[model samples]
Target: MAGTSDPLTPRAKLAVTAGKAVAAASRAAGRGSGSVIGGRVALKLDPDLLARLAQNLDVTLVSATNGKTTTTRLIAEALKAAGPVVSNALGANMPAGITSALAGGSESKFGVIEVDEKYLAGVARDTDPKCIALLNLSRDQLDRAAETRMLAENWREGLAGTKAVIVANCDDPLVVWAASSSPNVIWVAAGQMWKDDAWSCPSCGGVMQRPGDDWFCGECGFRRPTPSWVLSGDHVLDPHGSAWPIHLQLPGRANKANAASSAAVAAVFGVPPQVALERMYQVQAVAGRYDVVQFQERDLRLLLAKNPAGWLETFSLIDPPPTPVILSVNARGADGTDTSWLWDVDYTRLTGHPIFVLGDRKLDLAVRLEVANQHFQVCDSLDQAVQMCPPGRIEVIANYTAFQDLRRRVGN
Candidate 1:
């Protein structure tokens, strides 16, 4: 019986009001953004809070192992071409954080949510999104998150029978399988870099035949669907063969791929490709992913590389040889305690750069670098690493919690 026309009950209204107050207090105390704790408080007071708050809006949920925060940001900005949009812009993807975002912007006409891969189905069911964008899946947080195939199967079951039109990357075999249950799918050719996790077919336990960009299961006859939207270099070609240029302030091919996906999601909500690209071009940073700051009079560009796949993409984005590269890592719960994924990364690619490692788990990274025969210094502090380097343009690459710690230390 709950509908957009239904106003929040007195109890739900009180919960929203209380959540807002707690959120404000937390922000004032400088504890953190307070999205999670505030949402938790609200949900405890009213279990049906998220569903009620999203009733009036057209929701679009985005999920992936990597590029999630950045993709969610791009989608939210592009959707602004439609009207006011409510989004959890600070990378909070859980139900509690989602409840906080929706309650905060109760009157917004649309909602763009970035969900952790594990919780995508639950959020989709609760929000009943008009569309869902599935980017690509790779190994991430092995200790805390589900394996790629299992998660993709979870997505397949969770999204089945939902009326939401799925915009998925056909280049990823697992994503293709995940979106298979949905009748209405808008396949996009967003490239996948890490093939280690998806070498086998999720449908039949057979080896996947990946011949360049196209992948298929010879055993089960599962194949990559033809993508209506294709990303070629910096240009995105639409179904009509109209190539649109993405004038993004964010760097790297990964972000350009995100733009293509964002455009597709925006189009589902009636926003034109040109208009969406215009709005997306204005976003320079997503929670400091590509933020440049001054440290010891040097310009340090911040890049986040959490897992092996993410690290590979990030390697391509760093400045050319001899430019000092500071690599920071953490084995905290957020970054996944198993540091074994480090060995999977081709650290030899970092050979030419003057490398420095500093983090709670720098020792793990140092050992990996040593085994790869790549020269790097282990610094006790981020400032020490920066001071060791000469003049301008230092690259600071860190995983999740380390990135947060560096940002907080930089007073961002």
Candidate 2:
């Protein structure tokens, strides 16, 4: 549906009509399902419709394996701080999602959407964003995504002739390679935390050099550009109380990269470094991913892991895993119907045996956890899992659908 049409205006009109009908039906059903994109079924929509919807608005498109939501939110916040802005806050990153987000703010000056890596090119070709933020690529959703190299190819093809201000994470070779052909681009290196797992130099097939904190290719002398703003030192603090001064309101090593990437993009909008840094300190965490909740006398942490990279990063941050945890796995359409990506996650990091495992695929997760040498108490319902979970230091790992189900059950 995305590439078939000639003019986007007619397709957009049709999409709006369809969306309104669905929204009304969902409302009548007493469900908020209408806010979500691609929640019903995996029918591809025309990109022309998305292009027509973004015709008048200045658009900022963000794509990454991880941290796109946080980075998108921060970019939107920074832009809104300067003036009025519109965004799809629902975390829908597809063509229909782009349309849905635009449906909310028909008169806003700018539009920001966190796009999925696979659909980014179609969305870009359709939306024609004025600015594009290319973040790092990691192993995520391997089953659905094929592999990282394939995702990179999709990204490259989708972004051609975007005519947008390309803001890229220079440390990521794939991101850099994607932006190399772009006419106007600004490279933002993640000063201290830049990590590369590339096997050989794309340019010369030589080994890479890790000098100090940054990395460089040995043969071609290719290296990441110096950051526009470096978030160095040990103190990287986020909104949460500072255990580590370099506090990322989000958890894991990937989040620090996300924060730094957001700051780099914010600099493009003339947000002073200090002001942006201060704002980062005050920004609230996004829901479903490292969102901390309080229940009566219990402290609950909800981390979303729809893909392998996300799960691994979340696993890494949750160091010295909490005792008696809850792992929720689901295969609902919204949470990715295929749950095979579980093979990529390192469940071993969750050393302590979970007290409860919940989901449509609870046993599947239980088996995975068991293979990682952890024991689990499997439950069919989320409520049962929460009821069985102890009060202090409780953690929940959920996919998108399970999170929604768990939130509804727990009254969050």
Candidate 3:
């Protein structure tokens, strides 16, 4: 509010006040997480609360089927060097969550929001963001998000009229197709590790060719766009062909790609490359992602993999066999009631490793692992599972609900 000169309408002001009151009461009563109910009340009072609050703010929106949270955290961390920055860092990435974050950070002129893939179009249109980062498109929440191609088409239609500069991942064909029509686009080859969801060309419905890291559609002649910014091994290359070293505490090549995307986005906002990389290195974790917690004398490194594509990336980051790992799965509402996605993951990667299956869907995972000829033991108690592992650091890979439960047990 302090950064903007635009005055809020009386009705909008009343809506904001009522929303804040409801949020306060909800927190005091301990009935909800206090993230969405406040925004819900505000929207109920004034249906256009989001567009009003978003006015006169420079916003960068990050949306993807995966890595949106961590990538958003990286971008927000880097952009803070410019000035005061506000973000929805809690991983509540919907209309309600976005409204709550905007209301909470009313004094900041810059906003970095992580939006859900399904709701990206509406949020982007409402916020009129300065830049939109499109990470990748993959199968996620099949019950809710209809199809990957359909989502991309929706994004293409939603962003057709926006004037914001689009920063897109060129390595992903679906992403390329979605942002191709944008008048101002900056392509970054952030590297797409999971290709199971994009085996077919989004343009001509032809079989896509993946020769090494590059991809092309032979029938339609649609290929991976030549990127302006490329993420090579341990380095990010600029348009001038100069490379800068990237060092991040977050593990795996996926995080390196996230850093590259953040650096590209930061550059568009006038933040230097070196300065962005330096700021990103200081980020230890993002919303409990890749965070180490001590549980029962064992230091457990938590990794959240909600779907097959996420599992594929997480598996590639894990250390080779002989390392003790815990695999937890759940079929809760937040975890997507359908547990069929578990079968889509390649569990043979952990064949030789000692795996302890936990969570409500442990039996389901155990059966799948058995079919894949992977040896694993079932543990009813997480404490017992930890005790079974050797001393020192242990890896814990969990889905949505299981990961949240573990985070709660670890007390942050």
For this target, which candidate reaches the highest lDDT against the unseen true structure?
A: 1
Which tens-of-lDDT digit does each residue in 1-412 have in candidate 2?
1232333365555666667677667767877747554322212344445656677777889998767887888777767766677887768776666677776676576788899888888778767787889887766543456466567667766676668888887777767667766777776655323243354554456776766666678788866665444444434332222322344466666666666666666666776545655566556677555667776567778777777756666666653645567788888766666677776677777766565888898878878877877767778775666667667767777877888877776676
Residue pairs of candidate 3 with colliding backbone atoms:
1-106
Model 2: which ten-residue window has the lowest total lDDT? 236-245
Candidate 1, position 251, lDDT: 89
Per-model C-alpha lDDT, please?
0.91, 0.67, 0.89
What is the lDDT ranking, best to worst? 1, 3, 2
Which candidate comes out best when scored by TM-score? 1
Model 1 regions more than 4 Å off = 1-6
Q: Mind giving the per-residue lDDT tens digits that candidate 3 earns over 22-113? A: 88898899755676888888888888888888886789999998899999999998999998788989888999878888877767767999
lDDT computed for candidate 3:
0.89
lDDT accuracy of residue 46 in candidate 1:
97
Which digits, one per residue and each the tens of the lDDT, describe model 1 over residues 239-337? 888999989999899999999999999999889899999999989998988999987789999999999999999999899999999999999988899
The residue ranges of model 2 lying beyond 4 angstroms of the native Cα positions read: 1-18, 35-49, 191-197, 200-226, 233-253, 295-297, 319-322, 332-340, 353-355
